[model samples]
Target: MALQISSDCISCGACEPECPNTAIYSGGTEFEYFGKKFEALASDIFYIVPEKCTECIGFHEESQCAAVCPVDACIPDPEFPEDRSQLLAKKVHLHGS
Candidate 1:
């Protein structure tokens, strides 16, 4: 499953640079996919783009964001449940193997 930043996020921007897929976005900031832009998921806390997140499966043994998070606010996203293979496929789709 993709990881989601909870309301507990401190908005410290710690997890932003740790993401391999560039799925983490600052609060109130917009993100783009292909040629389409989307609104921020959280206006006051950092959010993850489920479609672009692969839990760092292709790039790391664990989610980098969670590993580096000081408050453990990064958790699995129930809304976008996915298995290892699926996550790997998403990784390939995002960045070629």
Candidate 2:
């Protein structure tokens, strides 16, 4: 599954830039991917775009958002469960391997 920023997020803006896929976004801010702009899902905390997130599979050993998050708000999304191969494929689709 993709990673998600829980309500525990402190809105520190620490995890936004560390994402290889640019999937992380500040609360209430816009996010772009594949030349398209996506609406913000959360207005009070940092948020992750599940369709754009690959758990840092192809680019890193672990989720960068989780790694840099000071409050441990980044965690797997149970609603979007996926395996390693699917995550890797998503990375390739987003970044063009």
Candidate 3:
């Protein structure tokens, strides 16, 4: 499943650099994907782009953002419940590996 950042986020910017897929972003900061930059989803707290989030499935045993989050704001997105194979495929799509 793709992980999500909850409202509990402290906006400390810790999880932003920890994501292997660069899915996490500071609130209100524009993010890029496929070479195109766009506005972020949230403007008050850190957020994760679900399209770019693989939960670190291809690179780690667990979500790096969740592991390093001090406030435990990063949690599974029940709206996008995906299994290992799906997550791996998404990772391959993002990294082109």
Which prediction has the highest TM-score against the true structure?
3
Clashing pairs in 3: none
lDDT of 1 by residue, 1-97 (tens): 9999998999999999888888999999998776688998878999999999999997899899999999999999899889999999998888877
Which model, 2 or 3, shows the larger TM-score? 3
| Candidate 1: 10-residue stretch with minimal lDDT | 32-41
Q: Who is ahead in TM-score, 1 or 2? A: 2
Better of 1 and 2 by lDDT: 1
* Candidate 2 residue lDDT tens string, 1-97: 9999999999999998899888888889988877878789899998999999999997889888999888899999999899999998998899889
Pairs clashing in candidate 2? 1-82
Model 2: lDDT of residue 43 = 91
Q: Write the per-residue lDDT of candidate 3 for residues 20-69, one digit (tens) a residue.
A: 99998888899899899999889999999998999898798888998989
Q: Candidate 1: where is the Cα deviation over 4 Å?
A: none
* Candidate 2, residue 49: lDDT: 94
Q: What TM-score would candidate 1 get against the native?
A: 0.94
TM-score between candidate 3 and the true structure:
0.96
Against the true structure, candidate 2 reaches a TM-score of 0.95
User: Which residue segments of model 2 deviate by more than 4 Å?
Assistant: none
TM-scores of the models, in the order given: 0.94, 0.95, 0.96
Model 1 clash number: 0
